[model samples]
Target: MSDEGRRTHGFRRRTPLGAARERLLEQVTPHGRTERVRLRDADERILATDAVAERPVPHYRRAAMDGYAVRAEDTFGASDRSPAQLRVGETVGPETATRVHTGSELPEGADAVVMVEETETRGESLTVFDAVAGGENVAPVGEDVEAGEALYEAGHRLRPSDLGLLKSVGNEAVEVYERPRASVVPTGEELVETDPEPGEVIETNGQTVAQYVERWGGEATYRDIVTDDEAALRAAVERDLDHDVVVTTGGSSVGERDLVPEVVDDLGEVLVHGVALKPGHPVALGVVEGTPVLMLPGYPVACIVNAVQFLRPTLREVGHLPHTDPPTIEAELTRKVVSDPGTRTFARVQVDRDGETVTATPTRASGSGVLSSVALADGWVVVPDRREGLDAGDVVAVEDWEWSG
Candidate 1:
C-alpha cells in the first residue's frame, strides 16, 4: 500500500486541521452521569445542575455605611446656613430622627441615612448639615442577589469565587458531572521504560498525555507499554474499549511498522488520519466499540501539539465540561518562523512581558522530537495555512498552553 493509502485506510486523503478537529469532536458523546458532593469538595468540578438561591441575600434592609438613619424629607434643604435640629429615637417621623449604625435595621419611618460627618449629635438631639435622598447609604432587601435566582448555571466549573457564592446562596451540596475515565497506551518496538541508552527511546508520552487527560476533567489510567506487533496493539486497544476514551501513542504514521491505523480499521472505523498540521500530522481519530480512540504521534512535540489541539477538547466534551478558551495576549515576534503554506503550524515561543511590550522569541529548537522546546515555551503562536510564514516583528496572539495544575 502507498504511504497515503496506509495512512488513510486506502482513501489517500488528508483532512484540514479545522475539519479534522470538528470531525473528532462530533464523535464525542457526553456522559450524563453526575454525583452530589459538598460545596467544599466541588472546586474545579463541572456543575451538573443549576444552583438556585433559596433565600434573598440580605433578606432585610440594613445600613450600608456608618451613619444615622433618618427620613430624607426631614434632612431636605438642611445645610450649614441653617441646620435642621431633631430629636433622636426609633419610629422617626417629621421633626424626629434616629441613630442607627451600619447594618442596623432602619427605624420604621426612616427612609435614608445621614453620614456622621454630616451630622452633629448632642445628648438627645441631632443637627443635620447635608441632605440625603431616600434609600441612600442603605442596602435594600435582596440588593445583592434575589431569591430563587440562578447562582450558577449547569456545566459551570466551580472556582474559588464560585464556592463562596454557593455558600452564600445556602447550598451545602452540589450536583456535578462524574469525571470520565480514560486509558493511555504507549506502543513501539524501539521504546524502553526508562534509562534508554544509545538507540532506545524512552516511552514518556503516555505519562504526559495522561496528565493532560486528568487536567481536562478525566480520570486517566496509564497502561503498560506494548511492543510493535499488530496483534498486541489490537489487544491493548480492545482491553481499554470499556473506558470512556482511549488514547494510544506512537505507530500512527504511514509506515510498514506503523500499525495503529490498520488496527483501528479492523476494530472500528478510522474517522480521520493525516491532519494538515505541522509536527502532529500523523494524528488519527477513531471509535472502537462505542469508545473514542485518539491516536497521537510518537514524537514528543507532536504528542504535545496533538494532545492540546485534539485530545483536550475531545475529553472535555465527553466529560460534560465547559469548553472555554484560555487567556491569551498579543505579542510581537522577535524572529521569523517558516511554515508550509498547506499546513497550520504551532510554534512554541518564550514570551517576555515588559510593561507595555510583549516580546515572543521562538524557542531554541523546533523539531518534533524536542520536548524541552515546549517545556521552555510560555505559549504557542499559530501560523494559519493561508500564510507562508510569519515575519519578525509581526504582532500575533499567543495561546496559553492547557493548564495542568
Candidate 2:
C-alpha cells in the first residue's frame, strides 16, 4: 500500500522514509566553498579551518585591583596591630610603593598589590595593614589564553561569545564554509500570489520553504510560481542549476499535470519518486546536473511535511550543519488517532496543561489541504508504521515541530 491513496500508476513503489533519507544523504557531500568573514559577521558560521591564538591575552602583567603596587616583601608581616611603613614613590622599589588602579600595568619591581581599603595614606609614606604574598592581586601574562594555543577545531559552529574570544586573541577575520544555496520553485496552474479567484488559490509553499531553508543555516531564493507546463517547469529548474539544491512545491504527483519528476529525469536522475510518509507520499527526491532537487506535493500540509522531513536534512547536509531534532514531551492522548498501516504518520495535536497533567488532542482538520490544522496546532504526535492506531489515554511523545523554525 502507498503512503496516502491506493497504489497509483505515478509511483510503482514508495520507498520507506528511512530508506529514502539514507539514499539521498549518501549522495550529499559537505560544502567545500570557503570565505573569509569579519568576526562581527561570523556568528553561526561553520569554521572552515582550525583557529589558533597568535598572541597571548593580556600580554603584560597588570594589577587586578585598585591599590598600591609594591614589592611583596614590603607588605610582608604587616597587620592591623603593627603595620608596615613604605615610602610613596614614582616607581616601586625596596620599601617603596606606587599607586595603581585595576587593569593598570604593574609598575616595575612590584610583585603584589595592597588593596586601598587595607592601608591608609600618610605624609610621604603608606601604611599597609595586610600581608601580600608574591604575585598576589597581579594578573600574569597569558592569564586568559596562551600564545600558540589551539582555540577551536575545524567544523566548529561559531557563536557570538566565541567571536568575542576570537577577537580578544587578535583575530580580525576567519575562514568559514559558505552557506548552502537553495532555490524554492512553486508550481501549479491555479495558484496566485495574492487574491485568488473562485477557481484559483494563493501560492504559499515556496515562501514557506524559503524561510525554512534560511532557518536551517542555508541561503534560499524563492522563485515565482510556475504553471503546470512541462517546458516552463524545465526552464525554471535549469535556471537555478548553480544552487546546491532546488526545491519544487507542485507537480510531484503521477498525474498528467505533475511533470517535475519527468523534467528532473530529463536533465539528470530521480533518486526516489515516492516516499512512505503520511500527508506527503507524492514527494520525490532527485538530482539534476549534480544538484539535488526535492519535488513536493501541491497540498499545503503535504508540502510542509515533506519539506521538514526531507528538505530540512538536505540543507543541513549540504551546508555542513548539524541536524538537531526538535524537543519532545510525553503527554496523555485525549482521543484516539487512526493511522494507515505501514505508513509513517504525523498527526497534528493541540496540547493542554492542567496543574501537572498534560494532554494532547488530535486536531479536527486532518486533511492534507487543511493548512490551519498544522499551523494552529502546538506540535505533532508521530505514529509509527507498526501501530494501526493510538488509543485514548495512551502516553505519546509529542514533538514541538515548529520549535526550530
Top of the candidates by TM-score = 2
Give residue 260's error in model 1 in angstroms. 2.3
TM-score to native of every candidate shown: 0.84, 0.93
Write model 2 residue lDDT over 1-405, tens digit each, in one string. Answer: 233432365567889899999988877777799999999999999899999887888889999999999999987799999999998999989999999999999998999999999989978789999999999999999999999888999899999999999999888999999999999999999999998999999998889889988888889999999999879999999999899999999889877678888889898998998888888999999988788999999998999889889888998898878788989999999999998888899999999999899999999999999999988999899999888989999999999866553
**Candidate 2 Cα outliers beyond 4 Å, as residue runs:** 1-8, 79-82
State the lDDT of candidate 1 residue by residue for 1-405, as single tens digits.
566666456326668898989988888899898999998888899899999987777878888877778888888898999888888776688878877788888778888989988889889889999988999998988898898998888988889898887788677899999998899999988889888989899888999999888888789999988988989999999998988889999988888778987898899999998888988888899988888899999999999999988888888888887777877889999999899988999999999989999999999798999999898899899999899989999999898886643
Residue 220 displacement (Å), model 1: 1.9
Q: Which stretches of candidate 1 lie over 4 Å from their true place?
A: 1-11, 69-98, 107-112, 128-136, 326-328, 332-335, 352-359, 403-405
Q: Which ten residues in a row have the lowest lDDT in candidate 2?
A: 1-10
Query: Each prediction's Cα RMSD?
Result: 3.5, 2.8
Note the Cα lDDT for every prediction shown: 0.87, 0.90
**Residue 12 of model 2: what lDDT?**
78
